[model samples]
Target: MRDWWRDLTDLVLPAECGGCGRPRTVLCARCRAALGGTGPCRVRPAPEPAGLPPVHAAARYADEVRATLLAHKERGALALSGPLGEALSGAVRAGLATVRAPGAGGGSVLLVPVPSARRAVRARGHDPVRRIAYAAAGELRRAGVPAHVLPALRQRRDVADQSELDARQRLANLAGALTVAPGCGRLLSAGRVVLVDDLMTTGASLAEAARAVRARSWADSPVRGAGSSISGPASVYGGETRERRGEQRNGPAQQWAGRRSGRPPVTAGADSADGVVDGMCAAVVAASPDAFEISRN
Candidate 1:
């Protein structure tokens, strides 16, 4: 009922720019340019996390971009999903270009979003990341790329709020909080999986998610009902699994180790059969973080 009323109200409300509150438009032209310009760029938190995948951000988390994202995410400015998805699609494309090798087989690309806690979803009345991922997939398909969203990742343990933590603290707090959904290993193994998130700060959340996904082992031979094969070291703090396997194999473990040591992580695209490209892709509509900040003056 609340959702229905909100939708009806939005339909009747006077137009206003979501970024700067300009009248007569949902997203004004100037703001739209600010949000979408410059193409996608690589972004790394000041202090990167361990084992984090290479990450690409469409825009810096500041200015008009920040405003637009917050408006859509926190205030339920649902109409902005189109532009946001478009922005994210660019990031996905950029991220894919970074990791894919020349002539690699392009299989289907699976976008696995980092799940929000139930409490957060209940408070917001929606799951923002999942919604954005769906929108992003649509954008990808329109560009002749086959993509799908898999909501098969979830928090396996409770975690404290992350708003106040530094990179290291954030890592410790989120270390074992994620797990693949039941029966999701096969889905992950079926194609390349790219972890997607709306915003990344410390990157602890994404790193932990990658770790959890990597840790779950896939049975060498397919099993009828073995329930996903679960092997590998479990974290002492949380009993979450940590290793994974499939018909497709990972690059030498050393390759990941060196990559992890060098810089913040970003998605790497994989090549598909018939010369289709697959790998991790990320996209965002805006890059400015300051746009969302409230001015005191």
Candidate 2:
């Protein structure tokens, strides 16, 4: 009922620009341009965190882009999810195109979001990244892309707040801190896995999220209830061939049909059969400026 009221109230109230607090506008034209004026492009963090998948960001995190994300994430400006999500959707498309094989149909994409710490979520009143991912997934599906929001990873242990941590320290702090929710490996192997986040800094969180996806290579085969042969985007890296990769894709997961009943706040992705998760990609609404400079080389 609370969610219903929130929805109805938003319909009746005059919305404000989430980016600049402009009255009677959800997002001013200037703010919308900041979402992805140049469109989505590849980005790479320096000293790229290990296991970090190839990533694309819709816009560079600067000026209006930075301010927009701050307003939405820290100030609970829920309406900004629309524009921000459209940017992320564009980035997801670019990321898929970067790794797509010739003659491919661009199979369904399962957007797996990096999980937020429970305490931080409580303080923020919502999971910011996950919210954007869901909005992004909705944008893709509306555009005829088979995209679904699957938040499959969770924090395995508590870590200190990242506000003061250096890149190296953040990486170490997040190392071994994420894991796939049990019984979702079959789901992971069923589609192209795209990790989605609202922003990327040191890339540490995404790297750790990738590590959790890799760990699912060891998951027990899917239980009979949710049985379905896997189909996924081929990874060109790690030298894993289609036929060799196909053999391992046939079986994954434990009991997705039975075990996961908690809605989409749970679920996950990545193609890690045969001990290699390739062709994996990451997408974000925006990335740090240094990432753009690094991608050029």
Candidate 3:
């Protein structure tokens, strides 16, 4: 009801540019360009966390981009999701270009949003990442990249507020805090999976998300579940898993039929019998400028 009312009010109320505060416009032409950035580029945080997937970001989180994200995420500017989604789509496409194998086509792309805490959703009256993900999916479809928003990951424990935490601390706070909800692991095999989020700072959130997906894939594997491999816990980044490298392989999870924050909130996969997670790349609307620098360096 709160989300419905907010959506209704957004249509009727006079609006201002989310990035620039220009009256009567949800977003201005200039700000939209800023939001999209110079085209998506790979970004990596300094001291990138272990298990973190390769990530692409549309824009640097600064100036108009920062203001626009805060306006939509914190201030309920629901209309801004459209522009944000478009920006995210570009990043997703960039990620696909880098990770996808040649001639690997046909399956729809899955935009698995990083789940928000229930408390945050109640406080904000909506799930911002999921909403933007839906919009991003629509944009991808229109552009001929069959896509769907899949909400499969969830937080298993409370986490400290990330505003004050640096990279290492943020990582420790989120480690082992997320898991793939039951039954969704099967769907992860249905297509290419790209983690989506609004922003990336330390990369801890994405790393943790990658970890959870890898863990779930192992559990879903009939061979692994049967303890057939018996080597060790599946490594998400190890060469053993095709999903980690963006290739899909048939595995226990696939036999049944599937495929598959923020802080600056750490809000922020597929399978084979070996429990290889599919497409371990991530896309975000923005990332800390320093992360982009780290990528270049």
The candidate maximizing TM-score is 3
Cα-based lDDT for every prediction: 0.61, 0.69, 0.74
1-297: candidate 2 lDDT, tens digit per residue = 533564565578898777677889878998898877688877877655544677889888888788789877877667778889899999999877644321255457889999889998877777888889989989999999999988889888998899798766776688668878877876876677788898898887886676567546334334421222222211111111112113221111211212244211112223344433235678999999888876731
RMSD of 2: 9.8
Q: At residue 104, give the lDDT of candidate 3.
A: 46
Judged by lDDT against the true structure, how good is candidate 2? 0.69
For 143-200, candidate 1 gives per-residue lDDT tens digits of: 9878888887889888889988765577678766888888886676555566788887
Reference-based TM-score, model 2 = 0.77
Q: Cα lDDT for residue 127, model 1?
A: 78
User: How does residue 269 of candidate 1 score in lDDT?
Assistant: 23
Candidate 2 residue runs with Cα over 4 Å from true position: 1-9, 100-106, 218-278
Clashes of 1: 42
The full ranking of all candidates by TM-score, starting with the best, is 3, 2, 1
TM-score of each: 0.73, 0.77, 0.81
Where in model 1 is the C-alpha error above 4 Å? 1-8, 101-105, 217-297
- lDDT score, residue 283, model 2? 94
- For 57-129, candidate 3 gives per-residue lDDT tens digits of 9999999999999999999999999999999999998877654431345377888898877888889989999
